[model samples]
Target: MPQPSQDDLKEISRDYNRLWQFPNCIGAIDGKHCEIICPAHSGSTYYTYKNYFSVILQGAADANKIFIAIEVGGRGKQSDGGTFHYSVLNKLMESGRFNIPPPDMIPGTTCSLPYVFIGDEAYPMKTNLMRPFPERSLNDERRYFNERLSRARKCKCN
Candidate 1:
């Protein structure tokens, strides 16, 4: 699948805001383990925490639960963030060529915010990527943010 262009990203963010009431969310990113037979002469490189030989499929789903961008075939030992770090998408973002939107204020708030891709803890937090706070720490505001982000992802899935 082709990566989302700048205009496509804008449309995705709008769709997410309309359907999930989450502002500035262009997509939800995640990684899945796809089971596979270990390849020739490769030892445990494909071995995963799930107790299987696998490859990782890292992808970003738009508001309609459609994959707008996907990267596959990373070794299972790689972390989601690490796989992403080495991806073309990451390179584009790093090169300032991905065309992510400029920072703007969050809806109904005085706080300025940047458009971002939401992901689970396996992904790192950045100006354009968001992840839930560590579970060990609890605060009302942090918990609310995580819950709302999760609900937005769920809305897309359904």
Candidate 2:
């Protein structure tokens, strides 16, 4: 087995960060579970959405929805927000570990564009991350946000 060098990690992060564009330019965040034999120490904490005692796997994807980095082995009961907090996502922001590019150069944009993650209901809302508003009908705010992302869209493989 071999380990990637620091440069390799930086390049990977940079690519994922630039994946698409603002609102559209976020990495995808999702969680899965890995089955494991019940551990005497934390069996109860390992129960998850699937009713299994397993370790959770968290991942970040590019605009293409291709996985860029992954973290696994946390207890399953952990919420997506909790999992992200303990994973590289946290360290990246705190230590400036991710290789995000400088702000976009498009004309007439006052907002400082941000690279973020697209999360689900299990995650928390914040500036660096976004989630679909859990409403029966998409209202004006959600509509505007969603419209911006889709308008700036990239292909699934892009």
Candidate 3:
């Protein structure tokens, strides 16, 4: 799929805020392993922790669960973070060409925050990406934040 333009990102952020109450969130990103037959001459490259031959499908979706971008065919043995690190989406983000919007003030707040994509613990925390606080140490505020973040990141499967 084509990269989202700045306008597209803005619209997505609006949807997320309206539907999920997550402000300045442009999308939700995650990876899934799809089972597949072992390829001839391929070694353990496709073998996953789940004990299956598969490929990783990493994707970012809008609040309405529409895919905005995708990267597939990553080795199943790779972690979600590892697959994302080598994805075109990551490259675009790293190069600052993904057209992400600039930082803006939060609604009813003077603090400025950058638009970000919500992901699970599998993904790294970056200026444009958000992950929940570590489970090992959690206060009431952090727990509530994790709950909200998880709600926003949830993608219903068909």
Candidate 4:
């Protein structure tokens, strides 16, 4: 693995703390392109999107909306929604090290409580994976979560 630069590490640190700032919160996630020079052998692997040829990097961040960690170099064809199924990120969530926030499906916990992670429509909405309310209301909990997200960041909440 390549080492993160001092500047990169600093930025990551800022975002990581930000995401964790809220109770039961994890980082927000999405993928975008970073242009790469084409390598002849793996020609088609470099696909184009929004007029750029690059690989998509998926990531998660904390409530403060800071970038805590990222999964990079996945083929562009991959969906951000599917990234969580199997990855280092998923493993961390499954393990106890990353405390799950409130509203965890698990009943009865005796301690300070783990933080919860928020997800979006692209992700499978579930008790463990929280998707913000739909643009049009689907249910009370969805509506509540959506409203909460919107209030957090002007155009973006989750």
Candidate 5:
């Protein structure tokens, strides 16, 4: 997939805000294990903890549940975080080539937050990536925050 431009990221954030009530969110990211036949001479390389041979398929989708980016061919034994860590998308993001916009104020608010992609705990937390609060001790505000974030992260494609 082609990389989205800065304007495209902004538009995706707007869509998340309008459709999912999640502000400053550019996309939702996740990974899936696609079962595959084991290759010759490959022992456990493709064997996953889920007891299957597969490859990881990582994807990021807009609020409309449209996939804008994908990374495939990761070893099935890897966790979502591991797969993402080695992905081209992560490299672009870390190298400042992803074209994400600078931090800006949310509408009707004075707080300046960086535009971010929402994901589950399997993904690392970064300035441009958001994960739910830990499930440990929870206050009302944190609980609500997790609820909203969970809703925004559910960008599964049909």
Candidate 6:
């Protein structure tokens, strides 16, 4: 799939805000294991934490639950973050070639925030990406952010 353009990202952010009352969110990202027959001579490369042989399908979806980008065939042993780190999408984002819009003031706050993709703890945090605070160290504010981010990321179906 093609990467979302700057205008597309703005619209996606708007839709996300409408859906979950969260601002500056362009999409939610996640990964799934699609079970498959073990490949000949592949060893355990396709073996997953769930104890199955499979391939990973990593995806990013807009607030409307539409996939904007997807990649398949990653080893099932790889975590979502690992798969993402090696993806073409990640390279584009890291190289500033993805065309994400610049940061702006967060809604209802004076602080400026960059538009970002929401994901779970399995993903890394970056200026253009967000993940929940670690559960063990969460205070009230962190808890609130985690709750909101969780709800937004839950837009995807299992």
State the lDDT at 20 in candidate 4. 32
Model 3 vs truth, CA RMSD: 2.0
- Per-residue lDDT of model 5, residues 7-76, tens digit only: 9999999998887788999899999999999988989999999999999999999999899899998998
Cα error of candidate 5 at position 2, Å:
1.0
Off by over 4 Å in 6: 156-158
lDDT of 4: 0.53
After TM-score superposition, what is the CA distance of residue 36 in candidate 3 from its true location, in Å?
1.0
Better of 4 and 6 by TM-score: 6
Q: Give lDDT tens digits, candidate 6, residues 1-158.
A: 77789999999998888888789998898999999999999999999999999999998899998999898988989999999999877888899998889997777789988999999999999999899999899999999889888888896432
What is candidate 1's TM-score against the reference? 0.91
| RMSD to truth, every model | 1.8, 4.9, 2.0, 7.1, 2.0, 2.0
Compute each candidate's TM-score over C-alphas. Answer: 0.91, 0.67, 0.95, 0.58, 0.95, 0.94
How would you order the candidates by lDDT, starting with the best? Answer: 3, 5, 6, 1, 2, 4
- The per-model lDDT (C-alpha) reads 0.85, 0.63, 0.91, 0.53, 0.90, 0.90
Residue 153 in candidate 5, Cα distance off native in Å: 1.1
- Candidate 4 lDDT over 46-131, as tens digits, reads 66655556777777654445556788876654556655665566665667434443332212334443334456666665444556
In every candidate, how many clashes are there?
0, 1, 0, 14, 0, 0
Weakest ten-residue segment in model 2 by summed lDDT = 1-10
Question: Looking at candidate 4, what is the lDDT of residue 45?
Answer: 66
Pairs with steric clashes in candidate 3: none
Segments in model 2 whose C-alpha atoms lie over 4 Å from true places: 1-26, 105-111, 136-138, 144-158
Q: Which TM-score value belongs to model 3?
A: 0.95
How many backbone collisions does model 6 have? 0
Q: Which ten-residue region of model 6 has the weakest summed lDDT?
A: 149-158
